[model samples]
Target chain A: MTAEDKILPKPLVSVRGLRKFYPAGRRFPWLRSKPPILALDGFDMDIFPGKIHALIGPNGAGKTTLLKILWNLIQPDEGLIESNHLADDDTVLVSGEERGFYYRLNGWANLVFFGRLSGNSRQETLSRATQLAERLRLSGILNRRYQTYSSGERQKLAILRALLQAPRLMMIDDLAKGLDPQATRELTDILLELARDGMSILLATHRLDLAAQMCDTITLIHRGKNIATGSPQKLSQQVFPHRHYRIVLSGDEVTARKILAGSITSDIEIKDGHLSAELVVSDEEELAKLSLTLAQNGISIIELSSLEEELETVYNHLLQDSDSNDG
Target chain B: MAAFFIRDLQIWVSYRLSLFLDIVGLVGTALAFFLLGLAFEGYIPPMLEQYGGYFPFVIIGIAFFGFQSNGLYGLSGSLREEQLQGTLEPMLSSRITPLSLSLATNTFSFLRTLVRAVLFLVLGALVFSVDLSSMNIPSAIVVLALSLPPFLALGMLSGAFTLAFKRGDPVRLVYGGLSVLLSGLYFPYQLLPQPLQWLAHAFPLTHALSGLRAALLNGASFSEVSTQIIWLLGMGVVLLPLGIVALKLGHRKARRDGSYAQY
Candidate 1:
C-alpha cells in the first residue's frame, strides 16, 4: 500500500456509458435481420472505498455481464472504466460460479496452483490456504478431490482462493448460489467483516433479502441499465414514499373512517363489529397528528406499529415500473 | 515455470496405465525401426552409406523428429485439455503474460520429449546393437537446440488459432500432418521426388533430422553441419516472432468477442 494520505476520495471504479452487444449468427439473406440483444447499454456505476455494493436484478438483467466487464474478462463495445490506481495486480480478484478447476486435483492442490498463478509464493499460498480453509470451515474437505466436493464447498473454495491475498477489491457473482442458509449467512458475515477491514466488495445477487441485510448500497438494474441506485431505505422510499401504519383501537368507526378517508388512504378491518385500521401517512408529522386526533376523540389505541418496506418489495416495484414504462 | 511443470507432472503421473503405456510405446516403436533396418540392410541406399547402416540413420531421425513433434503438439494439446477442463480462463485471468503462459504450459512436454528422445537413442544402442556409436554429442545437441524453436513457434501458432476460433484448428491440422510426412522420419530424404524435397527444405524438421542423423551416424562436427544449423536458426527467427504476434492477435480477438471461455 502507498501512503494512506495519497488515496483518492473519488470512486474506486468509475464506469460510464458502458455498452455491449453480443453477435447473433446470421443465415437468412432475403429478410431484414432483427436487432441484436443489448447485454449492457448506457450503464453507469461508481464503487467507492471500503463499501459493500450489490447488483440486484431479475433474470436477463445483465448483472453477470456487468460484473464480467468490471473484472476485465470481457470488454464492452463502448465505455470508460477508470480503475483505482491502488488496486493492481493481485490486489483485485473475482469469484464466480465458473468451475475453472482441475477435477482430479485435491482442493488444497488447486488452491496452491491458482495461488501461485495469482503471484503468491508456494509457502505463502499454503499458509494462507490453511488459514482461509479453517475460516471457511473447509479444512475437512481440503484433501478430497475437487470433483467430489459439493457445490457449496466448491463456491467456498472459490472464495478462499479469491481471499488468498486479501484483495482490496473483490467481486463475486451468483452470491449464495448452491449455499445453504447457514453457509450464506456465514459468507455474508465474513464479507461484512472484510468490508470493515477496508476491502471494497461488489456482489451480483438475486437474493434481495440477503442483499438488503448485507449490502450498504444496492443498485437495481433492468433491461441492461441501472434503474435505481441507493441505500435500501432510500430505494424503499422511492417505491413507497408514504409510511404505512397499522393500529387496532376501540373507537367510533364512523368518525375514524370519516377523518382517515378524507385526509389519508387507509384500510379498516372489522371482526365481530370491532374496528382495526391501517393507514398510509406521508410524513412523521402526519402520523403524530393522527395519533393526537384519535386521542382527542377518545379512541384508545391498543396497538400501533410502522411497517418497514422490504428490499424485495422495493426491487419488485421498481422493476414493475421499469417494465410498464418499456411496455 | 516450475509450477506449470509440477502441475502437469503430478497429473500425468496419476494416470498409471497411461504412464505404463508410454514406456511400452517408446521401446516398441524403436524396436520396430531396428527390425525394419535389419531387414533392409543389404539394400541400403548409397546416400545412407556414411551413416553406417539404416538402424543408426533411422534411429536419429525418429528420436529427434519425435522431439520436434512434441513441441509442435504439446502446446495446443494442453490448451485444449485445459479449456475442456474449464481451467483455461482462470489461468488466462492470472498475472502471467500470454507469452509466459504459452511457454510454461508446454514446459513439461518439452523436457519429457527430450528425455524420451535420449532414451530412444539409448535403447537402440543397448538392445538393438546398432553400433558402438561415433556420435558427435555436442553437435547433435547444437542441432537440437537450434531446431526446437521453430516447432514450438509452430505450436504457438496452432494454439493461437485454437484460442481464437475455439474449434477445429486449421494451422495444426494442415501443418502437423504435412510435417510428419515431410520430416523424413520413417524414410530417407533422397527417396522423395525433387519438387517434394524443395518443399521439405522449407520445414525446419527436414534440416533438423538431416543434421541429427549426420552428427550421430557419421560423427559430423558442428562446423560440418553449419548449413542445416543456419537453416533451422533462420526458420526459428522468422517463425518465433510471427507466432508471438499471432498469439497476441488471437488473445485480443478472443477477449473482444468474449469467446475465451466458450470452449
Candidate 2:
C-alpha cells in the first residue's frame, strides 16, 4: 500500500489491541478475594466501508464486548479506535437485545425518544418516526406500548429506530438468535437493501448460513481475537481442507471395501453395511482416477456430498489449532 | 444539557397525572401532621409559642423532603430498571454528560415536588390559617432554594456510590433513617437531645427548616436569621462541590473497573 492509500479515508471503523477485564470471583459472593475474569484480551479488527462483515464465534468469544467497544458504549482499556467517518455522520448501532426502547412508553414514543437522543429535533423525530414505522411495517401498532409487542416485533422496532437516524454505519450484534425463519429472511432482505444503498454494516452472528448468504466478507473471532478474516469460501477451505465427503454406494460390501481401500490413503470406517473413507486426492487427475477406478469395480455410486456447513467443525478446528499453539 | 433535561421533562409530562397522584399522597400525609398540630391549639399555647410557629414549616418540610426523596429514588430506580433491560449503556453512550442527564431525568419529579409544596401550603393555610406573610418568608424561600443544590448533590453522590459499589443501599438506609429522626420532619430540633440536635443541624434540611421557621412562623427578619442563612449557604457551598467531585470520581472508578453500567 502506498502512503496516499494508507492515508485515504477508506475504512469506517478501525480497532486495535482492545482489552477488558472483570473480577472473576464476583459470581461467588463468599469468595472475598480472587482474580478477575479477563473478558476481552487484545481484540483487533478493521471494518471497511460498503462491506457487510460478519463476526462469528462461540459463547464466550467476546463478540458482545467487541460490538460495545466499537459503538463507543464502553471504551477499551488499551487500544486505538479510529472512527472519524462515523464521527461526522449518524451511525446506528443495535445490540441483539432491544436495549434503547422504553417498555412503559408506546412504540412511537420510544422511537421518537431515541430519535431525539440521536440529535434529531422533536418535529424531525416525529416525522422520521412515522417513516420508520411504515418502513418496518409497524405503522398499525405504533401507538401500542412496547411491552405489548411480540419479541420479534420489538426487535424489528429496535432495528427501525437504528435506521431512523439515516446511519452511515450500522452495527448489529448477534441479531439472528431468536428470530423465526421468516423474520430472519425479512431482516436479511432489509439489511441487503441498506448495504446496497452504500451503508456499511458490521454484523456479529453465530449463524454460519446467514453469514454465508449475506456477508461479503467474514471475520472469525475466537477468545477475543480475530482468528481469520477473508471470504467465507476461502476461510472454509483454509480451515477444513479435505472436505468430509460422504459417499453412498450400492454394491457387494466386500467388493466395495476392496475397491475403496485400494485407492484410499488414510482412514476408513464401515457402518450400516456401507463404506465411508477419507481419501487424499491432490489434484483433479487423482479425483478422476479414483472415480474411474470405482466405476470399473462395478460399484454403483448412489450419492456424493461434502459436509461444509457444520459450523462446529470449523469452530473446533480453529479452537484446537489455537489451543495446541498455546500449549 | 438543557435539551436533554427538557426531553426527560417531556417523558415525565406524559405520565404527569400518575406522578401528580403520587405527590398528592405525599402532601396528604404531611397535611395529616398539620391536622394533629391543630388538635392541641387550645390547650398548648406555651408549646405552640415555641413550635406552633413551625406548622407551615412542617408542611413545606414534608412536601420538599418527599419531592427530594422520591425524585432521587425515581430517577435512580428508572436508571436501574433500564440497566436491567440493558438500556443504561446505550443511553450513556450519548453525548450528554451524566450530570445533565440526571438533571433531565429528575426534572419532572422535582417540578412535581414544587407543585405539591404549593398545594400543601394552600391546604394548610385554609384549614389552620397559619400566617406565612411574615418578613422571614423570603429568607425561608431563599434558604429552601439554596439548599436544593446540596440536597441534589447528596442524591447524585449516592447515585454515584450505587454505580460504583453495585450493591450498597446507603442512600435509602441513611436518608430514610435520618429523615425520620433528624430531618426535623415531625418535630422541632430543640425537642431532641443536645447531641441529636447537633446531628440534625449538620444536615442541609435542618438549616432550611430553621431558616423557614424563623421567617414564616416566628416573624423573624432576614437580618435576625443572618447566621442561619450563612449556615445554609455554607452547607450548599461545601457539599455541592464535594458531591460533584465524588460523583466524578465514582464514575471514573466504575469505568476503570469496567462496571460503570452495572448499576
Candidate 3:
C-alpha cells in the first residue's frame, strides 16, 4: 500500500520485538552451563484504547511475562515498548493469585495503604473503594481481615485495590481463574463498564469462552510469539476457514445431500442412525441459502445448531498451524 | 537475628507510626536489664571504673547495639519481608519513589531505635538510681544522631545485596556475627586483640559507642569526641551515596534478571 493509503489507528500501548530468557539447568543462573531458554522471543502486540485485547496460550506461553514487563515488575531483555501511559500511577497489573496483599490488615486498611502507594489520598481511596466494592458485592467484607476472606473474595479484593488507582491501562493476568460463574459475570460487566469509560485492558486468559464473550480482539500466542491477532470472528474464520453445522433431519440424508451438494464445501455426513448431517458452509449467505433450500424441500429440520462459537476449534487449528510452522 | 531483625515487619504490615507496643516492650526490656546490672554492680572491672559501673556502660553498649541493628537490617529486612509476602512487585510498581521508601523505612527504624535507647537511659536513671544528672546531653545527642547515617548506609548496602541475590546478604550475616564481638557491644574494644582492635576502628558503631560512653558516662563535650564525630560524618558522606548507588544497581540487576517477584 502507498504511504497515503496506509492509515492505521493509534494504540495506547505498542510493543515490538520483545525478548526474554532464563538460564537453563538447576544450577544458579550465572553458573549454569546450559544455554538459556527463551521465554519471550520477538513477541509483539498492541493494545488499542478502550479495547479488551486477550492473550491466549498454553502454560509457559509467556502471557505472564508480557504482563509483568508491561507493569515494570520485570523488564524485557530486548524490546521497544512505547507508551506514555505507563507511569507508576497510570497503569496497573493485577496478578491472578490473591496473595500480594497484607493478610493481617483488613480490606479497608489494605486499600488505603495501596491507595497511598498509588498516590491517592486515604479519603479518596475509601470513597472509591465504597463504590467499587458495592459493585463487586464485596461491600460487607471491607471491615474483615484479608486473610479471613474466601479465595474468590480475596481475588475480588485484589481487583478492587487495582481499580482504586483508576489507571489508564490495566493488565490483568488470568482474569477468570478460580472465579465462579456469577462472580465472573459480575467482573466481566464491571470490566465492560470500565472499558466503556475509556480504560484499556490487556487480559491474559486461557478461557476461550471468556475471550470470545468479551474481548474485542483476541491475540493467540504460542511459544513466546504471537501466532494470530484479530477479532474472535475473524480468528474463527482464519482458523476454521468455514463454518460447520450439525443438522438433525426427520427426512432421509439423501435429500439433504442432494440439496446441499454444490452449496457446501465438505461432504454431508450421516450419523447416529438418525438422519443427521454435518455440513460446512462458506459464509452466512450460503448458510441462509442452504436453510431456505432445505425448507423449500419436503424435509423437516429436527434440530439445527451452528458450531461457530466453538472457539476450541479455533485454538486447536491455530496451535497446530503454529507447531507445524515451528517444526 | 534474621527473624528478630524483621520484627519491623509488624510495623510494615500495620503501617502505623506510633509504635506504642514497641515502646512498652522496650520499657519492659530496660527494667529487666536494669535488674541484671544491679546484680553485677558489685563486680565492676577496673576498665569500667570511670563509667561509674558495669550497668551504665553495658546498658549503653546493648541499647546502641539494637540501634545499629535497626540501621543495618531495617532496609533489607523490610524488603525481604515484602518479597516473601508477595508485595515487593506491587510496592515497587507503585508511585512511591525508591528514595521515599528508603527514607521512610530508615526513618522509622532510626526513630524506633532512638526511642528504645532513650527509654533505656531514662529507666536507668529513674528506677535503677543510675545518676546521669551531669551527662553531656547535647554531645550524647549529637553522637547518636550522627551515628545513624553510616548505619543506614550500611543497611542500604545490605538491602542492595538482598535485592540482587534475594537472600544471605553478607553485610547482615557477617556484621551480625562480628558486631557484638568487635564493635564493643558487650565489652570494650581495648579488651580485643591488637589486630582486632585495629579492625574495630573501621566499624562506625565502634566510634559511636566509644563517643557515647565518653559523652554520657564521662560527660565529655563534643570537642572532646571530635575525632569520633569527624569519623562518623566522613563515613556517612562516603557511604550514604555509595549505598544509594549500590541499591540502584541491585534493583536494576534484579529487573534485568527478571526475578523481582521470584522470592
Candidate 4:
C-alpha cells in the first residue's frame, strides 16, 4: 500500500462518483428535458484525518448539497459513500439552518436530545450537555427556549449540540454568518483547536477570511461542480496575482481619474468623489514611486493598500469561465 | 433503543408545561363526558347494555381511540407545522431510526392518552355504576398489548403519507373513517349491519376491543379469547414491519426526488 493509504489511520469517509438530480415537476412529467436539474453532477472528494476543508461557493452552488450528502442527511441518487468511521464519523454537524434545532426546547434540552440520538447514555448526554453549555459560554441562558435566543446564540448552540457528539467529522454549514467579529475569531480558533485534536472539519461559508485563517485546504465549488481545490495560499497566489495596488485618492474624482489615466493600464472606477485606480506595479518601491507621483499631482492620498483578490474573485472568475465556455 | 427512549423523555421535558395543559384538556373532555353520563344515566344504558354493562370497555375504546386520533393528528399535524416552520429536515436527519423517532416524537401524546383512558375508566364507573372488575385482568392486558402494534403501524402509515403528501386529506379521512366504523368504539360488532360486521372483523381494532370486553365483562378465560388475541398479534406482526418499511422507502423516494422537505 502507498504511504498515503497507510497514513489514513481509519478511512474517514469516501464518496465515489456521487450524483444527484431533481426532476422538474409531476405536471410536466412527460415533457422531457436534455438534462435533469443536476444538484450534484459528479462529486469526488476525500476528507482525511485532520484537515479543515473549507467549501466556499456562491448561493445555489451545491456546497450545501455536498455537505448534506456527506452527512448522509439524504442519500445520493448515484454514488457509493463508505466510511471506516461509521460509529465515529456518523455525526452530521450543521449550523445556522432553521431545522437543526427544536424551537420549543431550551438549549440544554436540545443538546441532550441530540446527544442521546447520537447514542450517548442519558447520564452521559446530560453531562456532555452541561459541559458544552459551559464551553460555549451559554451556561447563563441554557435554560431559555431556543426561539428566544439571538441568531448568533442559536448558531452557537447548534455548534454545541454537534460538539456534544464529539464528532469524528464536523460539518459546519455556514457558521460565520450572523456572528460578530470577536465571535467569528473565537469560532475560528475553536475550529483550529478541534482540527489540532485530530477531528476533520468541513466548513461551508461565504467568508474567505475565516477559511484562510482556519482551513488547511480549500475547495471552490461553482454550480454543483468542483472548480478548484488547493491550499489557501496556493489558491490565493495562483488565482489572485499580487501585481495590483489600489490607490484611493480624495479629490475631484473625475480629475483624479484623468490624472491616474497616465498610470492606469487596467480598469478604474470613481466612487463617492474618490478615485481608486487598480494599477499594476512589480514591488513596493514602484508603488511608492507611483504614490509620490500622485501626491505631486495634487491627488490627496486618502488610502493606499495592496489589493489582494479573494475566493470571491475566484468564484466569479470560475462562473465567468463557465458562462463563456457555454457561449 | 434505550437512548432513543430517553431522547423521547428529554423531548417531553422540553415541552412539559405545554404538554400538561394538553393533558388537562384531554382528560377534562373525558371527565365532562363522565359527568354528562351521570346527569343522564338513564339514556346511557343503550351504550352500556349493548356493550355488557362494562363502561370501562367503552371508556377503554374511547381512550384508545383518543390516543389513536391524537397519533393521527400528531403525525399529519406535526408534519404540517414543522414543514411550515422548515424544521423537517433537521428532525429527519437525526441518528435515531425514523420509526423510533416517530414514537419518541409522539411520546407525550401517548402518555396523555394512556392517563386519560385510565382516569375515564375509574371516573366513568364511579358516576354510572359501571362494572370494571374482571376475573381475567391479564387477558385484558394481553389484548391491549396485542392491539398496539397494528394501531401504531396504521398511525405510521398515515404519518408516511403526511410526510410525502402534505395537503392531501385522503389518508387521514380513510384512517378516521375506518377506525370509527370498525373499531367497535361506540357499539358492539354484532350490532353492526352484516357487511359492516365483516368489515369490523377484518379490523384489528375490533378484535382487540372484543377480546378486551370478553375478558373483562363476560369473565371469559384467556383460552376463550386466544383466537382474537392471535388475530390482533397477526395484524401487528404483519402491519408493523409493512408500515415502517413503507415509511423508510417513501422517505428515500422523496429525498431522491428532491421533495423530502416539500410542504
Candidate 5:
C-alpha cells in the first residue's frame, strides 16, 4: 500500500444508490410518451474530509447532477445521502453557470448579499467579501456591475462569494471554465491551501490534467455509472498496461528513424526533425530491448525517460471500454 | 430578509431610468383619470355621490388596484426573474425557509407599490381637486391591513405555478383579469349583472375595494365595514394555508423534475 493511502480519513459525505431520471421530450409535443433519461443510476461515492476529490467525466455523465443533488438544489429520485456537515452555512456549491449573480448589482453587493444569506452579520460579510476579493485579485472589479465584468471576473466573483462563508464542504463544478491560465493557477493554489486547512472539496471537471495534479482521489463516471475510483497512479496503471517512453536522439534524425522503422516489437513515432521519438512497449523488458536496438544502430540516446500514464489517456481508454461494453 | 431587501433596492437603484419612468407612468395614469373625471363631471353615479365626484372614486380605485396587483403578481414576478437569471437555485439552497424567501422576494415590490398608491392618493387630492376632509383614515388602514394576507396568499399561489412550471401562471392571469374587470376597480360592482356580481364576490379584492371605498369615501367606521373586513379575513384564513401548501408542493415537484432553475 502507498503512504498516501495509509492515512485516508472517513468520508464526510456518503452517497449510496443514488439515482435520478429526467422526463424526456416534453418540449416535443409528438414525443410525450418517451421514457425518462436516466441521469444517475446507482451512483455511489464517498467524499472524505479535508481532501480534494475529483469527479471526472464526459458531458452528460451525471457529474453536475450529483453536485446539484449534494447542494440540495435538486432532488434525487432515490438515494441515501448522509453527510456529517451538510448544513447550509457550511456547504456551498459553485456552479458553472455565470448567471447566478444579479447583473444590475456590483460584485461587492452580490457577495455581501450571498454572505449574509449564508448567515453572517452584515459587517462581517462585508469584511469577508473584501478579504476574499483581495485574495482572488478581484478587488479592482468588485465595485463594477456584474454585467460589466468579463466572464473570468464574474467567475472569480462567484468563487469569492462561495469562499466568503469559509464553507467546510465546497462542491465546485467546472471551477476553471472561464479562467485564464494565470488565474487558473492562482485559483488552484488557493484551493490546495484551503484543502490543507481542512476544507473538503468535491470538484467536477473535464480538465483531467488539473484533476491529476490536485485531486487526492478521482472518481471517473461514464453514463451515470462509476467506472473507476482510485489514486491517479493506480487508475492510470490499471487502464494503461503498456510502458511508454520518449527518447531524444543525439545522432542524425534519419538514422534514428531507420533504426525504429519496421520495428515489430514496439510502436514508435518520430517527432520533430526526427530527433525525438515516442515508443510504446508492451512490457518493461520490451522497452529495454528497444533502447538496446537503437544503440546497436549507432543511435545515441541523449535523453530517455519513461512517460507517466496521463489522466487523459486513462479517461479516454476507460470511456472507450465502456462504450464498447454497452455496444 | 433584510439582505434580500437591500439587494433588491441596490439593483432597483442601478436602473435609474426605469425608476424614473415608473413614477412618470403613475403620473400619466392619474392624468388620464383626471381628464376622464372632467368629461363626466355632472354624470357621477349615485353610489359615488358621497365621494363628491368621480375623481375621488377613480383615484381610490387606481390606488387600490395598484396594491392588489402587487399582492397578486409581485412574488410570481420576482420568482420568474430569479429563475431566468439562474439565481433561484442558490437562493433556495440558503438557510432561509421557502416561506421566508417568498415574502422577502416580494418585500421591495410591495413597498414600492405602497408608495405609488400613497402618491396617487396625494396627487389626486392636491392636483385633481379630490376631497380629503371626510376620509376615515383608521378604517381605511384597517381595510388595507386586512386585505394584505389574502393577496399575499394569492401571490404565493402564483409563485408556486412559476416554480413548478417555467411558463406564465394561468391562475394569476385569470385572477388579475377578473379582479380588474369585476372588482369595482373603475365602477361599482352594481353595474355588473347579478351573476357577474356573484362571481366578483368570490374574489377577496371585491370585498377589499368595497371596504376601502366605504372607509375612504363615505367616512365609514370599523363597524360599518365589518362585513367586508370579515370576508377578507375569511379568505385569508382559507387561502394562506392553501397557498403555503401549494408552494411547498411546487418546490418538491420542481426539485423532482429538475426544473427549479429553468427559465
Candidate 6:
C-alpha cells in the first residue's frame, strides 16, 4: 500500500446491520396484514475520512433511504450507525429534493438561515456563504429568489449551502440529478477537491460512470443490500474474471484468428481486419505468455487494446447474479 | 430561533400583496362590526353593560380569538407547507430540537397576530370610540401572557397531527370551528344553551376570551381575573407535556413509515 493510503484516517461513519421497512399500500379493513417494503435490509458500510464514498444502486435500491438514515432525517427500524460527527455541526446533508429552500427567499437568505442553524455565527455564515456561492459560480444569481432558479442552479445552491457549513462529512443524495453536463463536471471537480482537502463525503447516486470515475470507493447496493464495496478497478476485476482484448492485425485476419484459436480457450471473432479474443489470465505474466505465443506464430500485432470492464456492466452482472440466486 | 424568525419575516415581506390584503381584510372586518355595533347599541346585554358596548366586548373576543387561531392553525399549516415543499426533513436534520422547531414555525404567525391585535384595538378606539382609558392594561397583559401556553400546546398537537397524517388534522378544524361557535368569539357564552356552555368551558379560548374581556373592559385586577388565568394555566400544564409527547411519537412514526418528507 502507498504511504498516502496507510495514513488515511479511520471511518468517519460506520453503519452495521441497518434495516428499514415501509408499509406497502393502504390499509384496508378486510386485509389481515399489509406487507412491508424492505428498504434497507442488513446494509453495512464504512466511510473513511477524506474519502469520497459512492453509494451506487438502481432506483428503489435504497440509496436515498440510507442517506436519510445517516443524516438523522429518518430513523432506522434496526441498525447501529456510529458516526464520529453524527450530532456535530460538522455533518451536513444536501438532499436532491428541490423544495428544501424557502422559495420566496433569495439564495443568500436561505444559505444564511441554514448556515446559522448549523452553528455558524452570523458574520461567519455570511462570509462562508459568499465564498461558496462564488466557488459554485452562483454569485451572479444569489440575490434572485430561489423559485426563479433553474434546476441546475438550484442544485448548485444546495451544494453551496452544504459547503458553507464546512462539514467534516457531507452526505449528498443524487448529486447530479438535475445538473447539465458542464455543471455536473464542475460539481464532480468540486467534490474531488473537497475530498483532497480532507472532507469525507457519502455520495448517494445511480450514476455509475461518475462513481467509477470520481469516487475513491464504490459501494454497490441492490435491493437495499450491499453487493460489493471496493475501488472501481477492484470491483470490475471481481465481477469479470476474464479480460477481453481487441487486436487489429496488419496481416490477414484468417491467420490472426487461426493463431489465437490454438492459444485461447475463449471464443475468437474476426471482423474488419481485427481479432477479438477473451483471455482468462489472472495476471500480466499469463497475458504476456499469450502475446509471445501469437508473435512466435509469425503474426505481427498492429494495435492491441484491452477492453476494460465498465461499472455499468459490473452493476448489471451483479444484479443479474443476485436475481438468479434469489430465483 | 432567530434565523427561523428572520427567514420567515423575509418570506412574509416578499409577498407584499398578501401583506397589504391581510391588513385590508382586518380593517374591513372591523368596519362590518362597527356598523353592527351601531345597530345593537340600544340592545346591549346585561353581562356586557359594564363594558358599555357590544363593540368593545366583541373586539376583545376577536383579538383574543385571533391569537388562538393564529397559534393553532399557523403551526399545523406551516408544518404541512414545509412537508409539501419537501423542506421538513431538511429542517429536522438541523441542530434545532423538536420543541424549538414547533415554536419557530409559529413565530411569524404569532408576531403577525400580535400586530393585527394592536391594529384592531387602535381601530376600535379611534373609529368606533371604544373606550380603553379604564382598561387594567397590566392585568390584561398578564392574562394574555398566561393564555399563550395552552394555545401553544394545542398548536403543537395540531402540528403533530400534520406530521403524522400529512393532511386532515381534525383538531385544527374542530378547534377553529368550535372556538368560533362555542367559545363566544362573536358573542358571549351566556347566550349559548346550558349544555353547550359546559362544552365551551372545556376550551382554553373560552377562559382566555373571558379573562381578556374582564381585564380590559371591566378593569378587573389580577385577583378578579385569577379564575380564568388558573384554568388556562391548568390546561397548559396538562396539555404541554401531552403535546410534546404526541409530537415526538408522530415524528417517530413518520420516520418509521419513511413518509416524513412525503406530503
Best by lDDT: 5
Leading candidate by TM-score: 6
Each prediction's DockQ against the real complex: 0.67, 0.33, 0.48, 0.36, 0.67, 0.71
Off by over 4 Å in 2: A2-9, A25-32, A88-91, A242-312, B1-31, B38-57, B70-75, B133-137, B169-172, B218-221
In order of listing, the candidates' clash counts read 0, 3, 0, 0, 0, 0
Query: Which tens-of-lDDT digit does each residue in A152-171 have in candidate 3?
Result: 78778877888888788988
- Tens digits of lDDT, candidate 1, A1-327: 567436646677888999988765456767676677798889999887799999999888888788767767777999888877854443444555647788878998898898898888999999999988888889999999898987778878888888986777888888888788887887888889889988889988888888898888899989899999988888988899888777777779888787678444456887665677677888889978888988898777778787779887888899999999989
Which 10-residue window in model 2 chain A sums to the lowest lDDT? A84-93
- Please give, for residues A14-125, the per-residue lDDT of candidate 6 as tens digits: 8999999887865776876678899999999999988999998889999989987777777798989887755566778887767788899898898888878777888998
Any runs in candidate 1 off by more than 4 Å, and if so which? Answer: A1-9, A25-37, A90-95, A248-259, A262-275, A298-304, A308-313, B38-46
Task: Pull out the clashing pairs in model 5.
Answer: none
Task: Score candidate 6 by DockQ.
Answer: 0.71
Stretches off by above 4 angstroms in model 6 are A1-9, A29-31, A84-87, A247-259, A263-282, A293-304, B41-44
Give me the displacement of residue B110 in model 4, in angstroms: 3.3
Q: State how far residue A112 of model 5 sits from its true place (Å).
A: 1.6
Worst 10 residues of 3 chain B by lDDT: B1-10
Q: Which one wins on DockQ? A: 6
For each model, chain A TM-score? 0.83, 0.75, 0.83, 0.73, 0.78, 0.84
TM-score of each: 0.90, 0.82, 0.88, 0.79, 0.89, 0.92
Error of 1 at A297 (Å): 3.7
Could you give the candidate ranking by lDDT, starting with the highest? Answer: 5, 6, 1, 3, 4, 2
* Model 5 lDDT tens row, A273-315: 4466666677778767777877887777778787787789889
Q: Which scores better on DockQ, 4 or 5?
A: 5
Which of candidates 5 and 6 reaches a greater DockQ? 6
Candidate 4: Cα lDDT at B156: 74
